[model samples]
Target: MSNLPQSLSLNVPFGAGPSGVVPGGAGSAPAANKDRKMASAEQLVLDLSNTELRENALLELSKKRELFQDLAPLLWNSFGTIAALLQEIVSIYPMLSPPTLNPAQSNRVCNALALLQCVASHPETRMLFLKAHIPLYLYPFLNTGSKTRPFEYLRLTSLGVIGALVKVDDTEVISFLLSTEIIPLCLRTMEMGSELSKTVATFIVQKILLDELGLDYICTTAERFFAVGRVLAHMVAVLAEQPSPRLLKHIIRCYLRLADNPRACEALRHCLPDMLRDGTFSACLREDPTTRRWLQQLLSIVGGNRVSPLQSGGGFEHMMVN
Candidate 1:
């Protein structure tokens, strides 16, 4: 069964002026301005329903997303708007099967995703967005192995939606994601995505690890811990050759959080990269004291030990950070 709806309709209107407001009063002008803007936003959203107008409407809505603080609910409750966005996503599946997505298709879908991200970020509608299972629709894009500009942009924009959900420190967000394939998808991106995509994917992982339940989940099994550890090890080796302080910061924080788990810390004693321990990243950490301190805390917690199961030719051996 298709995970998305063919169409949906909700008729919550905007731009109604508050009752009992006197004309030309101090409060009236601001209310009038608010109504006009809301009306314009509503028009832009309504335009999304028209087939010919969908592309320009999506482009405009995405560009002006921040301007409409109420845009999330507006997108959700407006007639046919959310369906239009899903249709935009559905239109791209054929391209994915054939690996034929172009820049134009990628941009349009990303614009749709940007609006979905807005919905995911809003406090009022985030859980509602989750209840509708909207994030699952984005997973295929993240799962793509293509490295072209089109796929890369699609993956990054899709990550932005998940990143927005996790950005606000909510256990529900972590809980929802932990229940899905988000982690493996993120790990794959961390392994193969461009620097920026990897950074966002790592940021998502870092946020998950920061949550207590998420930490317990990842550390609940050696398999999960080593899966994450191996990828972080690979990223560290890559960063050692071509450094990115931004990406390195998230990677280190994930390690520091893992160290908070006793078993993971024990595993890290042997498998944690040598470069992280030997000041290879000192220059990179010079400007970022918080991450520098995180690295220190991780080293201190894992301590100076190199004896563990991972030491005996675990999958991480080839990623030595020399």
Candidate 2:
């Protein structure tokens, strides 16, 4: 997923061709040429319905997704566009089992996912995107265990779609996700994905934890809290070896959010990794003042300096209290 917020500027030029037009450069085009470009992009959207034209159209739109600031409604309102995108996803299911997904095929499905991410990001289309159960279609990609480039790209892009949904403030997005296996899926990524993919997955979890309902859900059971806490603790240890300020920032935010719940906060007092409360990450977080502040606040709230029975380098799982 791109580091930019998923909710930021997803408009597509509905009728424009895939000229990859930049906003500043559009004013320089002749009026007649602009009309043609609009017609071409519209044709490209329409061509999504054509099996022969779909691949090229998907490529053009996906390549220039950032420029499609106004096209989400058009994509959603247009007939068969969403279906076409899902078709692109489902077609690749066969290859996933055998782990035969080459870069070319992965790129094609990822392109389709990019379009879906746009739809997932737009307010007008977001609820509709969820109502269609579209996010579930991408979970298979997230569940795959392959470390190949193609599979990694697929996982990262799929996380982008979920990340886009959670970027919205609505409880409905969290509600939908909490009802699914998204938490475990994200935890799996946090454990095994590349640094970038792990960052996106952790971002998704951070957004979820920021939601009130999501916080309650995670803390509702000792099992759930420990499930999330253990993975986060493990990631902190891994990053301590080879730091990623970006991923570490999200992980810290998640821990801080978990601290907002009384029970979870109490559990964290015993189970929160020393690396987070200690000065271990100070160098890695030198430029990130906000994360540094969050770390301090989390430590203060969880009574960070106190030693626990589990502090003898024991696993976080053993620190959980009933």
Assess the local accuracy of residue 97 in candidate 2 as a C-alpha lDDT between 0 and 100.
92
The C-alpha TM-scores of every prediction are 0.89, 0.86
Per-residue lDDT tens digits of candidate 2, residues 145-247? 9999999999999999999999878898899999999999999999999999999999998998999999989888778888898899999999999999999
Candidate with best lDDT: 1
Q: After superposition, how far is residue 207 of candidate 2 from its true place, in Å?
A: 0.8
Best by TM-score: 1
lDDT of 1 by residue, 1-322 (tens): 1332322224223422355342345568776776666667777787788888889989998998888757898788766678889999988988997699999999999999999999999998999999899999999999899999999999999999999999999998899999999999999999999999999999999999999999999988767888999899999999999999999999999999988877676678788899898889999989999998888888888775465554544323333332
